[model samples]
Target chain A: MAQVILKRIASGDKSAVQDCLKTYGGLIWSLARRMSPNPEEAEDAVQEIFIDIWKNAARFDETQASETTFVAMIARRRLIDRLRKINRQPNVDSLEDVLVEPTNDREQDLQVCVEAREAAAAMKNLRPEQRQILHLSIIQGFSHQEIADALKMPLGTVKTHARRGLIQVREFLGLGSDFEKEATV
Target chain B: MKDLQDNRLVELLADQSFFGLSAEEGMELGQLKKRFPEWENDFSLELTAAAIGLANLDVREDLPANLRAQVYANADEFFSEGATDQEVFNFAPSANKTIVSPPGASVAETTSGFSFWQNLGWAFAAVAGIALAVNIWTTRFEKPSEVVKNPETIQMPKPELTTAQKRDELLASAKDAVQISLTNPKNEKEIVGDMVWSNEKQRGYARFRGLPANDAAKETYQVWIVDETQDSKTPISGGVFDVDGSGEIIVPINAQLAVKKPKAVAITKEKVGGVVVSKQENVVAIAKV
Candidate 1:
């Protein structure tokens, strides 16, 4: 069997570091660049992200999520922490810069690709306003108030759309309804 | 009957997974999970769906070449330090079993040389002491399986060294390594590179120019160290990596086994995440060592 990079890294194989960077550099780099306020901050965040990965390499559970997903989770957690640390709200100008188009790359895992397609399809079932609100809140990293301000909607309406839209997506994916029924019983 | 309360709970769970929750909300989430174990699975699936949706953004961009160099240098320093620590505490017996006599101990106070048999007895005791120490140390701290299961216990503090300093250290260590220039067999002008390998040190670096970056989702570039000394025809794996841009890229060579006599190094395009044994049908470059 091909050696898992994280397993090798946990065993102190120095070369696995290079292999890891080569494998996930683009993903982390793009995430950091998009999330950070500037290129320099993105570069610094990338370094921190790698250090975190090395420290937590052994914790990676292959059965629960793909390596890409695991790494993405770490990257997002660090980026969000940084965002919160700075106490800066998501800029209105940057909202337009967020990439909204979905990719049809065949290289993604079949399961992930299918899930992404389903999520995208399920999103289309939402009202355009709810869909836009969720995209801003989830993908753009905007708070409910910031999204409301950006869209010129009432704060309560923003929260309503975000909550209702997310619940709809979860139901569409066939996840929340069963749990909800079971919980009430 | 799922009512307003149920809808509110679903919303809270979704928000918690997406952007994190406040302390009170987090406590509430814990209570909810404890009350309904099924909610945990539902939460995981929701998070997975959210991640998938985000992955569809296709926001990949090439990192700056200098940043890549810094990352490699930092990793090299970090792992090398770890190896040095392990060697000191875990490998060397003499270091672990230094014999120190108590103050005014009669055995060391006598300067006269002892008989050969007596010296041999002392040596055996020292060896036994080292063995016991090693056993206790390994059992206490170096359990590989435990480390894999709980990485938080082994995480070290980050080093404060600068990137340039780490890169300098890495290059200084590899200064005596041999360098071999690689060429693209099909089109020499299109892909070209060199590999710097130190057989004694069992480490090497590869630098390539003009090799186009691949879509890592579809394919990745795999490195192979062809050691003719090995009985098997299969070359030792040098690990799989991907290029992100058309410029020069420096990659560390990760040989899966000890390379006795490396005859050549080759790079091939393989499926994403790479392969155990490359078919070598799509060889991009080769360096005859």
Candidate 2:
């Protein structure tokens, strides 16, 4: 179905572009959510991704790859682009981390979008911003500027939101042995 | 096991990175790291429990950058004019208006006019045909991917003794002790100690302080490496002796390898110079570490 939509889009059918958006809208939103610092930045990333998909859909070679692969490549490219931008800022690690487990739901959600609903449902403990910040900073790597622009707030406001958000996460971890209580998280 | 680096420890404390570690859990990690010497041996269970206790305070700040659309807006304008370079024909801004198509026109009428339709018809047809033909031409584009015939399962190389590699890997995992703790069956409380690891010898040394004070020695407290690798084997000798005014003794290790990775560290009572394994004077009171 994505293949047909993309082919139609490449064939210059505007409605096919709309159809692609309709079907893949949730997928793109979830990806943006993973990448952005908050819901607002996610909203912006979603818009940017869609506009990019529409404009570049002509280059999509349907026979060369599946539509999911094509869309995923675009999403991953945009995400890595964001990561590179963040990497330009001061970073915490130059070496690769050796941890093996999927420490959070964002990883599971990113690997499988269909699982996001289940993951979100299972996210009983994380507060909204705690989930939002982890999704944005880790997955999206959006800078404070992008977050500020999306949120339409002062730079300090965005920083405060992120700082306060992390405190809540620390609070959750303090309450119990989250590592031992793996089933609950 | 390799020594945990400070930066790696910081990463472990980050929420995105080590979500598995709770704040209280991270506290234990931080506490041990703060107290232990930068490079030392004895990472006992007490240290781990202590690290877990301090886990609750770790926090990370990571965010994104600016996104401006002017560059994109310009690109959109360029592409809408076809893939042709707008920069090339800037002199003919008015001329572009002459070629604009009517809002509504029949398909036949649209193709009826101009040098573009008449002279460029063959070129258009050729491009379209090529576009369509490429699909047919590469009929077998899905040709079987060349398979690399490398062995799927690689056997792990057996560990070879290299004084250099051993020293380095140990340096990565080892830590230095800050204080020493020692106790005996009589003075079972208040044992503080410092530890160090020797990769070349495959052993760790612990120096004791405030240990059981013996007078001319009937018997002294012994340190043993509770060997965990050999089926939770008996506690093996790590040199033992009485402490002087300084309360210091260097113990040679046989199986403190368990401390590098183990359930706990057990202190036992024994004769001087130590024995091969924990005996009748076996494990006095084990430190939970």
Candidate 3:
């Protein structure tokens, strides 16, 4: 039974801050670099991301998601907000490049987190086009239009694939029912 | 129809989670939110993307050493005892320069030292305010004063004192004044300034030699007085001012609320007109009491 870093951070445990930085710094740094338009913005984003992490630490519930998933989720939210504020899109690979490459180049490192492993397994259930669209849009930070243009597909079709792919993943991760229960309540 | 709309809501949420929404889609989502308010906090796609992104993260490059230190420094301040939860923040100080009151001066000596300085506040305010009002009224309604014989006799005007001079006079006179140098904690370039406060007078002033000027349209400098009387998290805002020029400048502290025993004064760059509570991310300079 390991201590939840976020819970400790919420309680103002100084050592937990150190542990959090050590554990999630790389993940967040990578996300920021990929999502922000420039290094300076990335640096600022990281600082603000950590602040958001601390502010939202008390809300971290281990039962809902793994620590890695929770940290990544928080980082994504801030990065997305920053992107919207600046009205700039992330630098993304051309659709052809994404299509030709190995889908899971870092698959070996996927075992580092339970949620990642589960997500990787769940991604296999989507249709090939849906999986590719999700990878381009979600993992590579491409917009729906960008993905549609890159893939030479209709925008509506791209949106459908992305939405269905995410729904499939949500179900695979056993989140759909919980979400439904919460929504109905 | 209900099922189709529910699906549309899910589509919008999933799209928003992935790459945000276009203006039209955002409006649609806002309308749908009214229909399905339960999904307001729903972040399933975001969580899915994060999980998938975690599996795909290629460069888990460690944070730069300098950046790591900054994160720790920020945490120290964010979690500092009695620090308020400010969503907006400024910079930090690399070094603290505290100038305490000179050794063992009695209340009698300090009180005598401030006699001229104490009266100056009242005299200066009354003269300036009344004179300006009179000047404006006379110029607008009546003929201006154009006397020839002894112009100086009609208006016995004292020389206007610059803010720097006022600050200097206060420093020379107030024996209990605490002066602390303010600096940028995270950067190499030094932000030169000193914040001075007198516990006896409950007055303070800030002087900066080379602080950068700010755009009032975008942001302004806000002063904060951290004291023992109130929670450190919600330090009294000492009012907002702008640096419209390049050289040395002095600003009078107009603490919107009184502080009894101030432990520190800080200046943060904030949105135009300043914020009621700062997040402190943009704190440019700080002086410890």
Candidate 4:
């Protein structure tokens, strides 16, 4: 698929960009939105993602991953990188929620709810602290020691939580044990 | 590497923030991965890990048209002018550019020849255009200012928005629900979102913070208000407006008129196409408003 896009792009296929947007806009938007500080930022990130996609269309490798995933990953990374300059706040209790204007886009709402529920259920397996730690360290990607110092816990405790937390997550999904099995160097 | 029993390393792989790990941290994680092979290659966990960070957050798909044009204009100027593979996105210097121009293509088309690059260019261009369009489509057409040049040429109303205008603004802003979290404990640093339910302000707004910086060009969070007033089923729109993106801004909410409290308040990721129904994800931050 990427090869087709690459070939087509190489051939000056004008419609290819829209096709890519049609195909992966949602995925890229999702990934970019995660790292966006706010809606406008996310919107801007989407624009950048597409720009980067077009600029790099010649380099897409279909063999490496799905084109959707590839572009989405690129978008995801760009968003994350953009996020780095800003202070990595743990989570701001949404301040303006009290007055948020209601929208009428129901289907989109339902879709987001469905996906959010799935993601939330996966998160439910995590203990509140585990979830927080994971949110800070993994999702937000903080160092263990860094997390340890922030949370003011022993380094060992942080490690224990991460390991046991991961093990528990594996169990929550009802998978085999030994989730942290050794890797081949 | 075998004895890399550092359990802390295992935590890094599970972190969505693993992309920014330092070299020492990376080495440490790599060692742990050698000891725990599954850590580096857990697809299911990675999916969940990735999605979890994104959960409860909105992705904006609306691109203003002008921004799209600006990017395209720039691309044409810089990238199009260079016949080299510089447009090719190879992080490494040695990567070759792919040229897939269809047969019988003229050299004039060399700039956007790759059928896919053209698509790629259009996609970006689409976002820029959307941004411009959004800016234009958004502003209510007010009467243009008159009087050539007197200091007071224009009659400035003491108050810009009349009561009716204010109501209209509110109605417009009420068109979409801004995701918010009134219940979250203050001072918490997580990016908690909730629904914004109001009809006396702009047509759109969101109460959000803690998100990392990223381009939000064609992207905008939309409000979805479900109305069960007249009918037992089906929720309708209030209105739609792009997020101010400076923390939060008022947007019109759209739901059954006169219904202060709609059945449900929700948000969706809308497209530059501005569809009545969004074919995208919603953070699903449920709210009583």
Tell me each candidate's TM-score: 0.46, 0.25, 0.53, 0.43
Write model 2 residue lDDT over B1-289, tens digit each, in one string. Answer: 1234433433333322312344565676567457544412221111221122112111111111111111122122223344244322211211121222123312112122334432343344344442232222122112224112322111121223233443344446545421223344456574565444543333444555555565434555565554343334443334444555654444433331113333345565655434333444455535433
Cα DockQ of the candidate 4 complex: 0.13
TM-score-better candidate, 1 vs 4: 1
Residue B251 lDDT, candidate 1, scale 0-100: 73
Per-residue C-alpha lDDT of model 4 across residues B1-289, encoded as one tens digit per residue: 4344644654565443334455676687777768767555444334334444444433334332333333333333323344545343211111101111113422223243444554464454344443332232112112233233332322221222332454444445555534445222333343345444553222333444432222345654555555544232223434344544456333334331234345565555454313333333543233444
Tens digits of per-residue lDDT, candidate 3, B1-289, equal: 7666777787777888888777899999999879878777666677878888776564435775445544554465456534334211111211100001112312112122323332343344344443442232222222235434424323322233456776776687789878888777665257578887776555568888777889878888888888776555667677677898888888877564435678877889987756545678888888777
Could you give me the TM-score of model 2 versus the true structure? 0.25
Relative to the true interface, what fraction of contacts does candidate 2 keep?
A: 0.00
Query: DockQ score for model 2, please?
Result: 0.02
Listed per candidate, the RMSD to the true structure in angstroms reads 18.6, 29.2, 23.1, 16.6
Best by TM-score: 3
Please name the candidate that would achieve the greatest lDDT relative to the true structure: 3
The candidates' DockQ values read: 0.10, 0.02, 0.17, 0.13
Give lDDT for model 3: 0.65
TM-score of the A chain in model 1: 0.68
Candidates ranked, most accurate by lDDT first: 3, 1, 4, 2
How high a TM-score does candidate 3 get?
0.53
Q: Model 3 segments beyond 4 Å from truth?
A: A1-3, A85-98, A103-106, A178-185, B1-4, B22-37, B81-289
**lDDT of candidate 1 over B1-289, digit per residue (tens):** 3354455566566565456666788788777667656555554434443554354444333454446544553454345443444433332222122242223322222123434543443465466564453333333333578667866533332333343443344457655568788899787665498877877556577788888889987888888888865433456667667899998787766564446678888999987655544667899998787
- Over A57-93, each residue of candidate 2 has an lDDT whose tens digit, in order, gives 7766543334554564455445444444333221112
